[model samples]
Target chain A: MARRSEHTREQLRDLMLEAAEQLIVDKGLAGLSARAIARQIGYTPGTIYLVFANLDELILHVNARTLDRLRVPMQAAVAATDDPEQQLLGAARAYADFARSHPNLWRACFEHRLPEDVAGPDFIDARIAQLVELIMAPLARVSGAEGAALDAAAQSLWSGVHGVCILTLTGKLHMVGGQATEHLTDDLVTHYLAGLVMRAAPADAR
Target chain B: MARRSEHTREQLRDLMLEAAEQLIVDKGLAGLSARAIARQIGYTPGTIYLVFANLDELILHVNARTLDRLRVPMQAAVAATDDPEQQLLGAARAYADFARSHPNLWRACFEHRLPEDVAGPDFIDARIAQLVELIMAPLARVSGAEGAALDAAAQSLWSGVHGVCILTLTGKLHMVGGQATEHLTDDLVTHYLAGLVMRAAPADAR
Candidate 1:
């Protein structure tokens, strides 16, 4: 039997998703499309449309998978240590490592923008929330921040770490001073945490 | 008698650049191309090729102009305040404001990537360096850091701020939390500065 006749809808979906991911990994978003994915998986472009509502939907699925893969290392980094400071640093490092290792896939998670009329699937937002929460747990412990305060602190700190990774990968880091990406990430996490601790301190203590 | 006959090569380059920028402003990078620009300016695509080597070269020129425009407000921010903390915050807010107001142009500065075979012109790097130096001067005053240490401090802090702006614009900030972008930016700068101050403190005082 030919390979096309061997699978059901779910299996075909998986195969298509895998191919789309591989294409993005190899060539970034520019190389991704129903036709390209169909060619890779031995299916017609029409078949891909049957599996995915549109290219935006397919891209979201790929982004969701990338986020899920990213969560693993970050979760492990948090789990590997109990000290809040170390946990934060470890998580930051893990994020930088993932961005470095999977540069293209990682870029797609942020770089791909949907059309104005399209609504992104909610699960993508949920996955992002989960990762932010993982970082928040350690940050809350370190800063003693709660509710919205904790939310802002965690988000800001992560944004800083994320920024370091992005500029590093884009070759913009050297345009400033050529600091190592890891060191910049480390500095951001440490300094931000120290700042949080200071703010949380009683005025008399300072 | 055609509109194309009304300009010298330099004037045509300016007209094409303006059209390209407007297209980007209205529809982002997706809408930009030599053909589109040529059409908007009443010239043929061949005319664009005559003035610029390729689209990437034109984009670099556009980005360089954006950087130059961005420098004006940042320099004014730094010069506006004598306090290092306020200077840093002011410059950051200026960046955020510019990104918000001219989102397409600002995004184009970072989002447009040159082909792998092309070498980015040196002037782009120089433009970026000027902005980094603007941030670094305030940081050095605040942190008492100098040499490579100062360079690292400035780069890390600015990277963090840049990260916040990117995430906020991309809607990732809301995914993490609902804090306003400006407030989150305020938090990152204030906290990071506090951390730097704490670290700079004498051991006993700290």
Candidate 2:
């Protein structure tokens, strides 16, 4: 079926991303190629050029798409929660689950190196700030953690979750055994969260 | 310079890892090859076969050596700290520093998918657990943080630091101008530590 001119751009963009995603799934990021994407998406190589200036632009678009998809569930996970700790956990779980299910796209989101000529948009950072916003205010409200301590806690929590996501995504967690991974992650999160709360509780110090 | 068999094996292993490291530095991991390593190390292709079964083993040996090197600095970082939060931060900083300096090996450590025939040794878990011991016990003692909360906090901190490390290593943070990468990392670490403490604090009688 021929794509009409009005929606051809949108259709082609989606097609290109879908094609690239498939290629990555099968061959990893290095396997992606404009010619292969063109062939797979049923577009002539010239048509891809019409839609994307080059492969970098196409990759940037797909990378943005991956971040957008990740942000949605992360926001939803936090927004649906009222307890600060619970909210953090919800977001963490959502992040881990999404990363696991969409390993290729997720990998592209984090691991893809931007070429010298290209710059990604600021939308991804804004999305992260939104997720961070969900947790930060509640943290600042705590009496004892009004400053630097609060900041450290947030950074710590964020890194710990990212480690799990990365380890699971790259299949590194498998080396430790699945059950051990689960247990260790659980222990780590529990301990870190306690540290966070303790730092903010002056009268009830650790 | 012909040498004893013992010296030959030691020199070969060192040569292999040094060559692989240079290759990664030159062309990145995707361009890595056993043949390239053999050539760079001044060994015939067949000579590489004696030190390792194949390219994958060679890469793994290099990665393990890198990790072992990292463990020393990381342990020292934690050893220099007595406070719980400081201990955690010191370890995280050490980890981040290693990632920044050895982006290729750092990347290899997390990208741990195993081919069917490649079985890993089992001691890495115990080594990691040693690191965990440094961060876990002190962190878990915080107020308002019980079992699960503590665990989540630890996990989140690990992930957040790893995220920053990877982003910095891969130049994902290059777009953020004005501040040096070290400054940005410092800011990230500081805020994370604060946030963790804030989150863990229990609200009670003022």
Candidate 3:
């Protein structure tokens, strides 16, 4: 009987997250509320509190789910490519593709801010680290930059790709001639990686 | 008497924009509305519509003012430095600074979406072009990448900087030991510029 009850609770949590994600997809972040989630799930608001601490907690859980969805394509992209440059490029393209396909969920990952007094959960940090590690491998291979340098390079490069994605997603890039997101992503990764490789090259080769 | 009324009409327009900007600063974009702007400026909602076509137009004008504010610092940054690399770096720093200082207004520049049916005004396009042109001279000096290449480079680099600013501004970067925005900005500009210069360098020197 206890096992069945535990199983039900887990199922309820999943249902709430799904309902919340769907709400965001349909009406954006503003549309999400405990009352709304309960209505979507056909449950009382008290049932939500029993499963999750609050709306902020629910948001984090949803963002974690988004990160998980993001990880699959990114890992697949990395696995599909053997060359370091292609691996990095593929991962970036995958990231942008994920953002485009799941605009609201992907955005919520970045857009949602926890309150000042509240600290982000450790699991979310682990998720972000996992995403960063995906790029670190190819970056380390290309630049031979290790320790802090490698970290900075990975963050900087990823930020650039992310910037391209944000601008492209938001239509900000349209004003500049509507360059395709893939082209911009490729341009950023290609040029940035080329620069890294050349910087690491020997002076005689230069 | 006609000229005096025209002057008052222009003054009212300026007053309305100022009020709207202040409201956004105080309460964010969500708090902004035609009625709110009218209230802020001691006028009726109908008065705001009379001066600007609608709330969206007022937002656009406010964004234009933000862009104009951004341009001043960027151009000043360019003028402050003589070295091509320094000029580019300075301009990037300036851009980031502008975003940081006017978080609401800077965010509004990207966050405000015009209705799909309405075409963005030509003046907004011109404002964006002006910002892009700030980087062209230094980029040309560094890479000799002209015309299409230069334009691509400028857009790519700025996008990278913009990404860093967004991440830092939004607290997303804090998850990674809280790296300073300036550090990320410098790292991106340095590495990207270095790569551009190296690519342009003669093979023997490379």
Q: In DockQ terms, which candidate is top?
A: 1
Model 1 residue pairs with clashes = none
Q: Rate the local accuracy (lDDT) of all candidates.
A: 0.86, 0.63, 0.82
| Candidate 2 chain A: 10-residue stretch with minimal lDDT | A172-181
The candidate that achieves the highest lDDT relative to the unseen native structure: 1
User: Which ranking of candidates, highest lDDT first?
Assistant: 1, 3, 2
Estimate, for each residue in B1-206, the C-alpha lDDT of model 1 and write its tens digit: 16977999899989988888899899888789888898899988888888999898898888999999999999999999899999999998888888878878988988888776765679998998899999887888898778877787888888898898888877776642224667888999999999988787778877
DockQ of 3: 0.53
Model 2 scores what on Cα lDDT? 0.63
Better of 1 and 2 by TM-score: 1
User: Model 3, which residues run further than 4 Å from truth?
Assistant: A1-8, A44-47, A175-179, A201-205, B1-8, B175-179, B201-205
> What lDDT does candidate 1 reach at residue A21?
95
Ranking of models by DockQ: 1, 3, 2
Off by over 4 Å in 1: A175-179, B175-179
Worst 10 residues of 2 chain B by lDDT: B173-182
DockQ of all predictions against the true structure, Cα-based? 0.82, 0.27, 0.53
True contacts kept of 3: 0.50
Q: Give residue B6's lDDT in candidate 3 (0 to 100).
A: 44
Q: On DockQ, who's better, 1 or 2?
A: 1
- Candidate 3 residues A1-206, lDDT tens each? 12223437889899899999999987777679999988877787888899998899999999999999999999999999799888999999899889888877888888777765777789887888899899999999988888877877887888888888888777766533334677777777777877777677787764
Model 2 fnat?
A: 0.30
Question: Among the candidates, what TM-score does chain A have in each?
Answer: 0.95, 0.79, 0.92
